[model samples]
Structure formats: C-alpha cells, structure tokens
Target: MMYDQLKVLEKTIIDIKKKYQLVNDELNSLKQKPNTDPKELAALKTQLSNYRNEHDSAKKQLGDLDKRYQNLAEAHHMIGEEQDKLHKQLADLQRKNSELQQHNDQLKQQNHDIKQQNHDLQEKNQLAAERTQVVLKRLTRIDQMEG
Candidate 1:
C-alpha cells in the first residue's frame, strides 16, 4: 500500500511539473505574439493574468499535497511502531497468564480499528488522485481551446 501511494504521489508530481512547463511555454508564446490593437492586447493580458493566477494556485496545491504525503508517511511509520509494540505486549501477556486473554482480544480489536483507519486514508488518497486527474484534464482542454 505504501508503494502504491508512493507511485501515485510520484505521478502527481510529474503531472504537475508537466502542466507547469506547458503553462510557462504558453505564456511565452503569447508574449511573443505581435498585437496591433490595444483592445486585443488588453484581452490577451487579462487572459495571461488569469493563467498566471491559475498556475500559482496549482503550485500551491501541489505544495499542499507534498506536505500531506509527508504527514501520511510519518503517520504510517508511527503506526508501524505502535503495532510492533502492541504485538510485543500481547505476546508478553500471553506468556504471563491465561487471564490476559481478554486483554489480548482487546488489542486485536484495536489493531483491527487501526487497519480500518488506514484503509479509509487510502481511499481518500485515491479519491484525491481522481479529482486531480479530472482537474488536469479540464486544464488541458482549456489550454487547447485557448491555443
């Protein structure tokens, strides 16, 4: 699951980078175009300004995603360590007495809950990825029309 999430993160970074380059190239192209009419030039300038805003917004979002990914990774590591500690405690309890069986069962349930939470996180990440893809496609379509 970590590997899958890593792959998705990597792909998202690549997609964002490509989009950034495309927007940069488009801006350069628009700037190089000669316009004799002041009104048309103003319109182009407005459009360019809009594009720049959108690009900046995208960059901020990418940064936000990177931060989220880092947080998730840290949480994952912490959870693993917690699970290991739980496993050790459970084993020690088992060796100490049969009365601790109830405690063991509770720990198992806690582990189950943790696993569910992890699964939910994964689902949320997947949904975020889908939304990102949709946004990217829409941006591409807009770029095509503008071009």
Candidate 2:
C-alpha cells in the first residue's frame, strides 16, 4: 500500500515539474519576442503573470504533497516494525503451548501411578482386617474353656 502511494506521489511530482518547466519556457519565449504594439506587450505581460501565479500555486501544492508522502513513508515503516513484533509474540506463544503440553503429559502419568498405589493400599487393608477377625474368634473359644 505504501509503495503504491509513493508511486502515485512520484508521478504527481513529475507532472508538476513538467508543468513548471513549460511555464518557465513560455515566459522566456515571451521575453524574446519583439514587440511593437504597447497593447500587445501589456497583454503578454498579463499572460505571463497568470502563468507565474499558476506555477507558484503548483509549487505550493507539490511541497504539501511531498510532506504528506514523507509522513506516509514513516507510517509504513512503523507498521512494518509492529508486524514484526506481533509475529515474534505469536511464535513465543506457540513455543509456550508446546511446553505446557509436555508438562500436562507428565502430570497425567503421575496421576495414573497414584491411582495404582491407592488400589494396592486398599488390598493390603482388606487382608489385615481378615487376619484380625480370625484372631478374635480363636480368643473367644479359649475364653469359654477357661470359664
């Protein structure tokens, strides 16, 4: 987009330059022409004055356009820098996501191991309860004989 604007500005500058040169040449030609009639000379002077005014106006416009073009170029450069920063941010986020995924996988494996350990503890508790029950029954029988 900036390139296109610059191209258009360059073309406008070229056109304005051509017009200025043409006006200058015309004024010079009028100066060289041999004049007899005062009225004709006055008319030529008026025409030259008009041409000079037009040239001055064109020059002012060209200056304004040049300033605008410079501003646009600066804006374009800033936009490019911003784009580069955003691209870097995107890349960093992607890398962080990858690391998080790896961490999540590790946590999942740990969870599975903890569940297996819980199951083993439950089985051990059941066996201990059965042994206690058997010992109680044997003690009750012994107590009755003693009574």
Candidate 3:
C-alpha cells in the first residue's frame, strides 16, 4: 500500500515538473520573438503570469502531498510495530500451552501409578482375610472334636 501511494506521488510530481518545463519553454520562445508589438508583449506577460500561477499552485499541491505521504509513512510504521507485538504475544501463548500440555501428561502418569498401587493393596487385603477365615474354621472344628 505504501508503495502504491509512493508511486502515485511520484507520478504527480513528474506531471507537475513536465507542465512547469513546458511553461518555461513557452516563455523562452516568447522572449526570443523579435520586435514584438506592445499589445502582444502584454498578452504574453499575462500568459506568463497565468503560467506562474499554475506552477505555484502545482508546487503547493506537491507540498501538501508530501506532507500527506509523511503522515502515511508514520502510520505504516506504527501498524508494523503493532503487528510485531501481536506476533510476539501469539508465540508466548503457544509456548505456555505447550508447557501446560506437558504438565497434564505428567499428572496423568501419576494418577495411573496411584490407581495401580490401590489395586495391589486391595488384593493383598483380600488374601489376608481369606487366610484368617480358613484358620478360624480349623480351630473351631478341633474344639468341637475335644468337647
């Protein structure tokens, strides 16, 4: 976009320069014309004045355009800075999300280990209870036999 605007400004400047050059050539040609009538000279002077006015106007317009281009350049720079900041923010967010994912995986592994330990403890408790029950039955049979 900036390039496009610059091109337009360059073209405008070129056109103005061409117009000024043409006016200058015309004025030079009028000066060279020998023994020119007073009325003709006066007319030429009027034409010269008109050309000067046009040149001045073009110069003023060019100045205005230059100011506008400067403003646009500043705006473009600011937008570029904002884009860089946003890109950095996105990168930081991605890094943070990756860290969180790694933490989640670690927590999942710990949960799995705890569940296995709980299962092993439950099996051990069940085996101990079965052994105690079998011993109590044998003692009760022996006591009945003695009685």
The number of the candidate with the highest lDDT is 2
Ranked by TM-score, top first: 3, 2, 1
Candidate 2 lowest-lDDT run of ten: 25-34
Mark the 10 consecutive residues where model 3 has the least summed lDDT: 27-36
Give a tens-digit lDDT track for model 3, residues 9-120: 8898889889989998988887788845889878888988999899899999989998988988899899999999999999999999999999999999999999999999
RMSD of each: 42.0, 2.5, 2.3
Reference-based TM-score of each model: 0.53, 0.80, 0.82
List the pairs of residues colliding in candidate 2: none
Candidate 3: residue 98 Cα off by (Å): 1.3
**How displaced is residue 138 in candidate 1, in Å?**
99
Candidate 3: which pairs clash?
none
Judge candidate 3 against the unseen true structure and give its global Cα lDDT, from 0 to 1: 0.91
Candidate 3, which segments miss by more than 4 Å at Cα? 139-147
Off by over 4 Å in 1: 1-6, 90-147
Residue 98 deviation, candidate 2, in Å? 1.8
* Alpha-carbon runs more than 4 Å astray in model 2: 1-3, 134-147
